[model samples]
Target: MPWLISCSAGYQKATNTSLATTFSNAVERFQRSYAFPGITASYVLPDGTSHSAAAGWADVENGQPMTSESRMLAASIGKTFVAATMVSLAQERAIDLDAPLSTWLGQNNWFQRLPNHRSLTIRQLLSHTSGLPNHVYLPAFVETVSERWPEPGNPFTPETLVRFVLDAEALFPPGEQWAYTDTGYILIGLVIEAITGRTYYEEVNDRFLEPLGLNATSASNKRRLSGLAAGYAAADNPFDFPVKTTDENGVMFWNPALEWTGGGLISTSRDLAKWGAAIFGGQGVSEEILNTMLQSVPIGDDMPGTYYGLGISIFRSGPLSPVFGHGGWIPGYSSSLRHYAESGITIAFQVNSDRISHQSLSEIELCLARVVISSGEKTDCVP
Candidate 1:
């Protein structure tokens, strides 16, 4: 799969007409190529100009069109929200990042069951260095969930998820080698609940959504908000496969209680663009704390120029500029949120299909970057 390469040169502001046309065409190509049920994308320039484009069907069965306001599950992009919230909590002295998980969560049955429970720090959990076994990767866990799908009382609690991985061995010693684990963020959510005496969702709402006024973003499994785009999956696999509307496998069937802080966010590209500007542009955390959160560790040779920070991934590979954001994958949705620091531009896109490969998503982002760059000379666009 060849990716559309991006030029490293500085970007100039292009007319909204031209940018929107380019973006819309690119999105149409992406949709047709991957047979995505629908795709919604929005970009915010530093000067506050916003451009949005949507292609395909939000509800294929009903012939609904994808719109800028259509919401899609934001998968792991929720981790970036978790990371920002943690930074805010640390600043308020509500929780210490370096503190061991045992300090706040307490030594319950789950803690006692897992060795080295006391050695894992909040920082490690945020950075995926806690060596915790990812519950999603466990075959038994996946099978159990699949067996219970769409059934009453099938949702797994955060504690239950921790218990499922308690017997599994650690991937590495805490704070040693970097490894991405949804279990780490699950623990982080639990820690937040412990320290604040409120559910993780509540804290996120108060700290992030409320302050930023991002009304479109919320936990997927929680309340049913309006304008949510229906989710779908490819008929076969996502790679080099065709998508079918009847092949729908929406996240509505998944247990929201299980995904929690790991990847349960549902949001629109417009709201996510606002979130990217607020969180990455230093609206929530102080400069020092934000810098700390952005500091990343390499994940080894498999992913060159790719590093994992607290709840975020930093990509510096190829001629494309470095971006600070995260991608998300749930049952019936895929999302990508990116902030190009040099251009002061933030782009976010969400599709109803989860079958799209990460590489394909990256290319979508690259296409957006290419459009922004090819527009003309530099402007005062700073987010």
Candidate 2:
């Protein structure tokens, strides 16, 4: 859901320092300038320095402060977790990356009903070249989510989401074009369950989360989460959420399960940075496979200066250029995680409100970069 994002590069063990002070100041400055309720940021510089900062209220009504540890829905970034697992499996020859959808999903009678389902392959889905239309944006799906308000108890199964796009016309032939779609990742999650004989969350949990000690990361399947920040949305947004997304007691109104494998994890800025550092820093997967992941194709102006390779996003233009990572967005949260390739720095930022414009998001991303990579020079995140 993020309109912008930032991770990739060589390894570095960053420690705490002035990047912390500047990052904290810049986060506070942007949080105020944009009148956002709350925002958090974390970074790992090449100098063995890593830091996290936050400003404003996590829950304005309850008067809870948004801390560096506050958790928010990570949105599409969750796709990276799924992609990493699938890629690792591919690397080990446990899963064939080039296989067709029919390899695992063909058993379903409705498999051919999905756009390009006849010829879609695992790699195309991973790189978002599946040409499959996103089910989330379907008018029927949106109306259904709104009609089924109070998303808890009334969950949208991953298969049901794909069904919405059934019989839908193809956006283009498989592997012929690119379009970002949660439906593709949801399919990946389903394939994971089929191939591993287990849930996708369990696979990711056992493979990455537990061993890496990413305790702050958890699947966004519950209505109530510990230390979760209140998210803000527009009064008349398409998703039909309230202006304030959480209750007075910090419980969410919607069923987080609706996001599923598409982008269903909740995490903090600190955990986000660590995950980026570990994964993109050449520790998550072998460099040879990582190079294949970095084989990016242009993603067009929707993400200007960005390219897609496997599940990772590479922003190759502007001040944040030549960095590898991904962006995430849900109804009420926006997130960016990036590893600066040129300087070996990893930074992550999360906002509780989704009302900010893409331009503002870009400015905030640039300011954060300027603060950390400028060698303690005076800088502002605002354009």
Candidate 3:
């Protein structure tokens, strides 16, 4: 229902490189353009050389400085985490990407109203092509049930999220159209629970977070993370309230049930980058499963530059370089984790304020890309 915001620092050196000036200039420009409360950036090159930097505040109200260890709401960027979990399951033979979900949920009668609902596979869910509408769109349900929910100190269970999706109508037949449905990922958490008999949070922690040593990150049920910045929204009534607590806005509430697999995990830039490297480097899953997770699936012509692949979006560069990874946003956060597979380099950006639009972020990202491309060691240049 809400996007997760996060950023990763860059630290990598090309075989024969010189991009320090370009990288510095790009970060300077991004800081100026957004006036972001804080930023943490890291990049790792193919050759094992890297660089990382931090700028801005981790907590604006308290004037806390942003750090590599400062945790932030990852927003929807958590989808990749969901994706990674499923990928691990696939490797372990607990789930099959091509198998229908009805195998796990049971009974075609429940979803029989929707054509091909039973035929929908876990893979489709991962790629957001199952054609399910966002369950959070039901205003009545969000107002009543969500209002009764707790605050950041408490997180909703994924089962609640699954119930919401099961009650909603499918957007289209499985694999028929593309809509970035939080329902798909919510279902993913369900599948994990159904098999493991553990909470989605625990599964993620035991399987991915703990092994990776991501001590400062979690689904963040509030409780003032050690160095987390408070997220800010553009305010429903700007004159009356320039920025509001995410809790005031039901959609902005940090209910794990609201986002589930789609958006919910909180993470720091350092941990986010570590997770990124783990995914790209094939640390946890088999090569084949990772390939499926990264392969692009068609989203039809309506959604430009939006292609679903496993748990991430394969954003084709309109005029810039091709990038892979998902973007997430919640009430007070906007974030993205992208990497160039060919170059073995990654870029993560997270902001505490959602007032900055995606278009603006894209422009800023393009400028950053230009810096990375132009300043890296050129193959054409003779050594």
Candidate 4:
């Protein structure tokens, strides 16, 4: 149950990017202000120029300094991979985004039992308008994971995870209301497997990871990962996890692959920043499919001006120009990826702990962005 304290590490990026020092100072400042154990950040400018940095301890207890190469679960930020893949598949005519579940899984005996299964469409699932309950929040499911964590093997496959929502009442009739649900993505994983006759992870690797040369990214199947930093969480968190999710050796107690299609990639900030640049730059998927994914739907009042488009989020909230991206979270880890529309810059930020607030993270992010904006001003332009 004791974590293995990792060795110290530091940011390693090409010296060409002039903002390296500024980015490093900004990360260290916010990480200290917020008292985060560790934080890593990376950005891709409109021209595809990129830089990265890290601060604090990746393993706080043993003092392993965070590094640019440190890996962490991307949580929902990973959903973008699945969403882009699903959209690409749609573009290939392998599946229809508007098709109902009855098209692919209608013959399965359990399909009819899923709430809204008869009316659910691929678009609805990606847009989170399926009204299906989130399996991760189900009491029984959370209890099982918390109690049996550290046990070998991932017991929850897409098939097994679906059972949590079986026969559960729909939050609302399909497409009538919008609610976020991981189960929808879990089901999407199953459909991808069904349609392509391959594991969801394999398909993603073929489409994104390998081609993009994202050497630091992978399907987060096992508990332990090299370069993965220890993640700190609340002891009383809903997942019933200990304060640190990984040991000093960077091994987690249980397989996070259970996240599967719901959100499964483990990667460094560099890879995430590169992936974000590709996505928003019209290189992640076919232009036609990417256009389809941009048709967003409102998430109702609480999030005003924010909308969901496929697996990505479109934010019109503040004064920082239009933003398109997604955030990710699981116990002990949190991440964010955003593309600044007007500036054409993409930035990815991650932390070893989930204890920090979104506002604080955003403060750190906008601060770093200001550096880039100011640098552009010297040239008489704003990036």
Query: Which rank order by TM-score, best down to worst?
Result: 2, 4, 1, 3
lDDT of 3 at 369: 50
Give the Cα error of residue 306 in candidate 2, in Å.
2.1
Which residue pairs collide in model 1, if any?
Answer: 46-382
Where does model 3 exceed 4 Å of error?
1-25, 107-117, 149-156, 165-167, 237-257, 317-320, 376-383
lDDT tens readout by residue for model 3, 144-209: 454554444343454554555565666787877777777778778877777778888898889888
lDDT of 3: 0.64
Give the Cα lDDT of each candidate. 0.76, 0.82, 0.64, 0.82
> 135-194 in candidate 1: lDDT tens per residue?
887887777776665565536778877877886788888888887889888888887777
- Which RMSD does model 4 reach against the true structure? 6.2
- Model 3 per-residue lDDT at 266: 78
Q: Is candidate 1 or candidate 3 better by TM-score?
A: 1
Model 2 CA lDDT for position 348: 91
**Candidate No. with top TM-score:** 2
TM-score of 2: 0.93
Please identify model 1 stretches exceeding 4 Å from their true place. 1-13, 222-225, 234-251, 376-383
